[model samples]
Each structure stands twice: as structure tokens, then as C-alpha cells.
Target: MPHTENHATHREVELLETLRAQGGSARTSHLADVLSVSEETIRRTVKVLAKTGMVQRVHGGVYLSNTEALDPVGSRLKIRTKAKGQIAAVAASMIPSGSCVFLDVGSTTAHVATGLRSHRDLKVVTNGIHAAQALVDNNDNQVFLAGGALYHVEDGTFGPETIEFVERFNIDVAVISIDGFDCETGFLLSSAAEAALARAVTQRARRVLVVTDVTKFGQSAPLIACKPRDVTAVLIDKLPDRIFHQKLIEWEIEVVVVPDSKTGKTR
Candidate 1:
């Protein structure tokens, strides 16, 4: 399907969601008014969405034709909507233009890629194809993918080459995901190769932000990819145990406790 950076397309998607939420039907003028966009833009979006079978054009409005098609990313997206969206939004806001970032693989990190779509002049290196696709979605960011074996389960690259490939870039911020986090044991990973790749990026970046949902807190994994001292900060849906928080402070690592619906800054 054709894509554009036009704000109208974004509005159209939002309009469709609004329509679905409001009994699956809405007038074009209402959508235009809600989006603060021109009526012409709404008409154009409606036409396109209608052709795609995403919406049906009625006499003076549109109705939902079909919900989004099911796909691999769908289920993971549903797992932590509020937390991931809030974390991604805040993380995306933290990125500066022209900054070089390293994004690791995971559903949460993919959301970070989504948040980064609007950024300009970014150098984003990633192991996840989905994350890399998201970084360059708007065609404004520079994206690089790690070369190696594909780990379908994680939807990313791995093996020795992927680890070595990541070591070459000097990243500004390394945004990584986690399988487990324990205040006493530090951060953990499910796969050794993923851990190796993450360790390389975390060590190389000027700063590191560990982004994960609350589910990772106190979780267990075999590989200890990093410790509190290895990262600049951790971003999560809520604070972990106090001992965990104390250990981070002792290591000079910042902790950012975010709500499931709100963005945040390090505290």
C-alpha cells in the first residue's frame, strides 16, 4: 500500500478508530472537525480507506468496513497497550534530532520504533526488522539492520555477525528490552545471542535506557546481559522493589517510574 508522511493519513487512521469507538459510523465533517483538518482531507482519506476496505463510504459519512487484518505484531501489541504506548511516547520524546540510537528486539522496543517514526535525521541501528522498518517508516530517519541469522521468534537478527556488526557504531542512546529484571540479580535475557548483542550496544552507547513493561520486574532469565551500572537509566510502568531502587542509586543509575497511561522522565 502507498504511504505518505502527510498528517492527513495519520488523522484518517485516528478517525477510523474514533468511528469504531463511536458505534462504527461518523460524518466526514465530524472527523474533520475532530482532527482540526480540512474537509477535503477527510474526503480524500475516506476515499482511500474505502478503496482499501477499511471503511465504507455512506451518503454523508463512513462506517467501519473491516477491522485491521490480523498479523504477527497484533497479539504482542495487545499485551501491554497502555504501558508500551506511554513508555514509547516518553522515550521517543527523549530522542533529539540527528542522534544515533540503537534499538533492540522486543515488542516494547518495536513500539519505540513507532514512536520514532516522526523524528528527523536519526541514525537507528536495530536487530529487529520490525523496529528498523518503523524507524524509517516516515523516510526521514537513517536505519541500519544487523547482519546475521534471523531469529524468527524474536523477529530479529542474531549470531556472531550481528553482535560484531553492532560494535562499530557509536550510538547516542541504546534503547533495549528485557526478559527479566531483579533488583538483586540485575537485568536478564532469554537468549544468549540477544544478550551478547545488547551488551555490545549498551557498552558502546553514551547512554542506555532499559525499556520494559512491569511484567519484567522480578522476572527470571538465564542470561544476565547487564547490571545497573551498565545503564544510564531504567524506564518501566512502575517502580520495582525498594532494594532494587536502592541498588540502582548506589550504582548511580536513574529510575523512571511511569504510569501505564502517562509518559515520564527519570527521577
Candidate 2:
């Protein structure tokens, strides 16, 4: 007998093939219209694809998954140090004194950890080894490391173990870093394991803030970490285009465009 085919899986495969043919970007609404399902359903399916590394979620749609590998963590750290530093400073300012916060593991989140080192009586729970190292070096605040499988590329820990640890604590805020964001996909990450951790952290926090640079906009990653509607705020280096800005407003997500003090530029 021939192998049975699941219609949902079949549709998803068809969608991926379509995305590959279209140069890697498609509007969510358009895809929904074509698929004859609700946009929410389409979005959820896309998130699964992102987690599996088969497709990248870009602004307004998804991208043909990239085959080019990312650079070493150390190299990436040097490339975006300044922008990440500024983003970290802004993210740190959002935390109230003496609050419990969850910090994601990434260069930008590491910057936030550095910026927050001086704040007194703050409790920080993190999975990033670099972030924990930064806090340990400063020795001014309380820091807890969520132990799990370490992914060298992110210089942090993730997996089921980390998810369990995060669930045990309720955080006042979560500052997450994203590989990219589009009005459609909200927040994207490079790995499915990282995206799982992000989703778990977002659920455990009272307020979730996505901290990223301007380059994140219009770009897509293989994993969808969160929907644009799930976040409370988006802190970026520049404002996105008017259309995307309006879409975010419609979703009730507050967009904070922080000017780059060094260059005095706005998105």
C-alpha cells in the first residue's frame, strides 16, 4: 500500500515549496487567503516551520530558509557590539529597581546584563552563559543561571531542562533578543530550541520586551519565537516603515524607537 498522507502536513509542504519558489517572502494575509484558513492558523503553522529550520520568518511573511551558516559567536559579538550595547542600555532602563527579570541569551541580552549590573537588589534569571558571566564579574546583583543543554552558537543554555526551570519562577519582565522581526512574524530566532525557550520565558513573565537592532526588521530567521501580538513592547534602534508601524499599533504592541546616540539616527 502507498504511504498515507496527512493533509495538514501536505499543505505545509506545499506552502514551503511555494515560499521557496517566490524568493522567500509572502504576506500572511495573502497566504491565508490562498490556503483558505484563518490567518492565526497560518501563523501558527509558520511558527512550526521556523522551529524546524525549514523556513525563515521575515517581515510581512516567510523567507526561503538560508543555507549559509552563521559566523562564530565571538565574531558576531564584535560585529554588533556598539548597537547591542546601546540596546542593552535601553533595555536595562525599563526594569524597575528590585524587580525579578528573565534575560535571554544573546549578544544584545548580554549587553542588557552588563548595563544592569549596577542596579541594586535586582534578581536576574538567565540561560545565557555570557550573561551569567557578565553578572558574576560585576557581583552587584543576584543572578541565577538556568542550567540546560548549552548551544555554543548562542553561548547559552536551552532545552527541556531550561524550560522547567523557567516555569518554576514568575518574572516581572523578560528581555528577549531576536534574530529578526516582521509585522507578520513578530519575533524570530535562529534555532528551534532557542525559540522554545523564548516562548516558555514569555509565558512566565508579566511583561515581555523584545530588544533588537534596526537590521532585524525585514529580515527572517528559521524560527518564529513569538507573535507580534504576544509582546508588550518592542525596543528597536529605529522605527519601521509606516505600514508595519500601523500594524503593530493595531496589535496593541507598543513600539519604542530608541535613537542611536552615537549617530543620531531614527528608524
Candidate 3:
């Protein structure tokens, strides 16, 4: 089966959500009951989710991967650091010093915020507390943080208030992050709140730039961030396969592959 088409099925999401509600781990039989499915069915879904690094299967049960836990900010920051930094460098270069920018709570977007630390006089809007902290105080920049419920899992804020605050800005560029992207889904996020904010900014911003590493290329997430038509560019650490590359062309999305610093050549 094609990965994109089969990614994050409704059953899989239900299973994961149930596991989370059960405190991030559960017995296989219990999961089968909660999802109202057979034990074999639960095993099959767990196997698939495990392959995607979303879960871990043990003797007779499964648990959410540390990277998939409710509070995953630290674990996420430790993953693909080099690739994320390279992509962030490319994304930061695209923004001028005095432009209005929208950033998000994803780990990759946190790296992008770091890259922008040196840029002065930026008008920034973001839900990531870390993102806002990174860009403030170094320069005469203005940062508006979305207030409401704090999403401790990703260490960000989101709610109707977050969405309304984001809609208030006419952003020059919205630099967001994603959990997955493919020809079929365009861009995907694991958090519904983050996805809502992404959608709001993509509509209001003049440009929407997605900052993610190559690992997300073939994966899937529960929420759709935006379609390819809404994105202005994608900054990544490496090139995607030929099929996905062609899809980017078809969608008229700009692909910015950050060069490998070791060789100083585009990967």
C-alpha cells in the first residue's frame, strides 16, 4: 500500500488517542476493547504505528513513543538537530531584518527562531513561548505571543484566543513546522491546535514557509496544516524523491533544499 494514502488511518488515530488517555501505555487487550476491535486488529495497527516511530510495542502492550508523548518538546529537540539547523539557516535567510514573521511551536520551528536571533527589528507573532523568547531582547523587535491555553506538550499556546490573535496580524512571512508532508496531504501536523493556527496564518500571511527535515517526507499526522496551494516555499535539509519533487512542481510550491555544510553542496 502507498504510505501516503494509508498514513494515519482513522483507526490508528483512535488507537493512539486511546493509549494517550490510558496514560501513554496500555495492554493490547484493553486497547482492543476501547477501540472496539479485535486483539489482532490492535496488534496490526500498533505494528504500523511503531514503524512510523509513533509507538513502542512491548511483550503484550504498546506505549506512545517518547517523541509522541504529551510533553515531547525536549525529546523532539534532540532529534535531527543537524538537519534542522541547516534547514533553519535557509529559512532565516529568506526573511529580511524588518519583516513581520509568524512562527510556530514545532521543534524545527524552534531552530528557525534561533537562526533569526541576530536579525534586528523584526515584528514577530508566535504561539511558541520558546520561539518568542528566542527572538526578543536581542534587537528592537516586536513580538506578539498568542495567549490562552498553554499546550505543555509542545510548550506552546493555542485556543480560540490564539487563532484570533494570529488573525490580527498581516504577516510578511509565516514560518511554520510540520510533522509530515507528501503529495497527497501537502503538509500535516500532529496537534489540532497547531494545525488551526497554521491554517489561520497561512491565510493571513503574504508568504507561508514550512520548515521541516527530510524525515517527515513520507510520514503522516492527524491534522492537515495547509495544502500545497497555501504554501509559498519549503525549506528542508535534503531533496525528496523524484515523485514528490514532481508533485511540488505541479503544485507550484518553491522547494529550497539546504546545502550540506560538510560538502557545501545542495543535497
What C-alpha lDDT do the candidate models reach, one value each? 0.73, 0.73, 0.82
Output the better candidate (1/3) by lDDT: 3
Question: Tens-digit lDDT track for model 3 on 1-267?
Answer: 333323477788778668756778999999988888899999999999898777889999998764343556767888788998888888999999999999988888888899998899999999898788888877888889889798667788888999998888889999988877767777877665677788888978889998877777876566678767889998887788888778888999999999998999998
Q: Tell me which of candidates 2 and 3 scores higher on TM-score.
A: 3
Give me candidate 1's TM-score against the actual structure: 0.68
RMSD of each: 17.3, 9.3, 4.0
lDDT of 3: 0.82
Instruction: Give the clashing pairs for model 3.
Output: none
Error of 3 at 207 (Å): 0.6
Rank ordering of all candidates by lDDT, starting from the highest: 3, 1, 2
TM-score of each: 0.68, 0.72, 0.82
Clashes of each: 0, 5, 0
| lDDT, candidate 2, 159-267, per-residue tens | 8999999888869999998776666556776566777888878866889988877677666554567666568988877787787778778889888887677666754
Q: Which prediction has the highest TM-score against the true structure? A: 3
**Tens-digit lDDT track of model 1 for 1-267:** 212211124455566646755566789898888878888888888887676445689887887753221123435767767788888888888888789999987778899889888889998988888888776647578899989998655778998899888888889999998766666557866456777787777878898998986666655444556656679888887777777778778888887776545233432
- Better model by TM-score: candidate 1 vs candidate 2: 2
